[model samples]
Target: MLCFGFTFLYVPMVLLIVYSFNYSKIVPVWGGWSTRWYTVLFESEEVWAAITLSLKIALMNATFATMLGALAGLALVRFKSFRGRTLFGGMISAPLVMPEVITGLSLLLLFITLGQLIGWPTNRGITTITIAHITFSMAYVAVIIQSRLTGLDQSLEEAAEDLGAKPFRVLIDITLPLLAPGLLAGWLLAFTLSIDDLVIASFVSGPGANTLPMLIYSRVRLGLRPDINAMATIIIIVVAIGVCLAGWLMMRQERQRQRDMQLASGDNIKQD
Candidate 1:
């Protein structure tokens, strides 16, 4: 089942990557192996602009989403008795279950109304798209952070407080360090979501603010473009490298955590 699922999901991407090297403009029909498509991809000014715009928005969205999401997650776990906690939790999570089409349309209408009323965000473009991405990406980030916090041993925090550490210091010296992996994962997820977003970005993006995904979609609508396939291939390579790095980091952290636990247990045994 796992093999089947892996093949089902990756086979198409693998085929697209393979075709990206083909000399033929026709996607399915291969003319021969060549890197001309990649050369074309790198040479296109519009494509480069779109890529830069996408990266900028994704970075901004990831930063804002991770910050807000971490706070929300902390609140959900640490302040369960707070006023309107139920409502707040639901609102924070709404984006996860909500349909993208509805979210996009509503946000578009909202931006239009706000622009007319406040004379702010005077136009929809990179700022608008980044905001939209942050809105939804933060929800996913919150869930990840919340789960990580739930598994953490709260006594470590208590011990820090007992040792004369202020609340803010405890967070910085203890909680945040422990949650680093989760934060990294959440940031990566937010970045991926922001860059890959098409629906919400399309709704909010204005002229001269085309994202990489939007540009690719527009081209593919006419037909398969070899340059787009080459771009996709490049993206796949980068993402794969990122995934490997993240996995390695996580594994290293886990090993360190396990060693710390063993040392603590030995200390307790010695004291007993």
Candidate 2:
């Protein structure tokens, strides 16, 4: 089943890449091989602008989501009990399970309401799009952090406290380090979600705010050209690189963790 799934997933992408080099104007066809489409992609100014906009939104969303979500995770996990805890948690994470269209429409309506009432966020462009991305991104971050906190050993924190560290110091020195991987994963997830967003972005985005995915959809609607093929190929390459890099980093961290555990065990044995 896994092999079949891999084949189905990658075959189309492989074909798209192969078609990118086709020397003909029509894409997904064989007509010799050349780098013509890639060159055309580089020369397109609209594509560049769209790509830039997407990157900017992704970076901003990742930053805000990571910081705010980490705080929310701390509150939910450390506070133990509070008034309306369940309600607040549900509200924070509701976006994750909700339909994309509903989420987008709701955000757009909120923006409109706020504009009319408070006269803020005057126009829906980058600001609205960022807010929408952050709204969903925070849920992802919180989930990641919450899972990490669940698996964490409570005694490690107690050990920190016994060593004369304050509660805030324990979090900064012990908890944050242990949870770094989850936090980093959350940031990357937020960035990818922001970059690939289409439905929510389409709803919140105003004039001159089209993202790369939106631009790609508009271009593909007209027809499939070699340039579009090239653009797709570029996106595939970028995503592949990101996945490979993440895998490599995770593997390295795992190996380092194993080594640390072994060393700690050895030290205990020596003391015994």
Candidate 3:
């Protein structure tokens, strides 16, 4: 089953990567294996511009989403009896459950209204796309952070408070550090979502603010091309490398944690 699943998932990608090097302009008709498409892809200014814009929006969206999501998670977890807590929590979770089309439509309407009411965001482009990405991305981040917080030992935070540490100090010294893995995961997820987005970005973006996904989508509609295949292959390679790197770091952190636990156990045994 696992092998079947893997084959089902990866066979198309494998084919895409193989055909990316095809000498022929037609995607299905493989003339011969060549690096011609890769060269063409590299030289394309429009593709490069879209890539640059996507990266910029993803970075901005990820950073802001992580920060805001962290704060929201902390509020939901720490402040147990706050007024309107239910309403706040519902609002935070809304984006996660909302359909992309509906979310995009609502945001588009919102931007139009805001533009008419106040002279802000006169034109929708990078700024609007980033904000739209952040809106949905932070919901995912908040869920990740909230789950991480729920699993954490509250005693450590309380101990810090008892030892004359201020609340902010406790958060800085204890809470945030413990939440590092979650924060990193959330940031990466947000970044990936922002870069991968198409529907929402399309609704919010202006004439010149085409993201890589939007550009790829537009090209696909025209017909498959070798350059597009090469672009996909490059993206696949980059994403695979990032995933492997993140996995390695996580494994290293887990090993270090296990070693610390062993040492702590040894020390306790000696004291006893």
TM-score on alpha carbons, each prediction: 0.90, 0.91, 0.95
lDDT of 2: 0.91
Tell me the whole-model lDDT of each prediction, alpha carbons only.
Answer: 0.94, 0.91, 0.95
Pick by lDDT: which candidate is best?
A: 3
The C-alpha local distance difference test score for the whole of candidate 1 amounts to 0.94
Worst 10 residues of 2 by lDDT: 71-80
Better structure of 2 and 3 per TM-score: 3
lDDT of 3 by residue, 192-236 (tens): 999999999999998888999999999999999889999999999
Which TM-score value belongs to model 3? 0.95
Off by over 4 Å in 2: 1-3, 257-272
Tens-place lDDT per residue, model 1, 167-233, is: 9999999999999989999998999899889999999888889999899999999998889999999
For residue 138, give model 3's deviation from the true position in Å: 1.1
**Model 2, span 86-176: residue lDDT tens:** 9988887888899999999999999999999999889888889999999999999998888888898989999999999999999999999
Ranking under lDDT, best-scoring first? 3, 1, 2
Maximum-TM-score candidate = 3
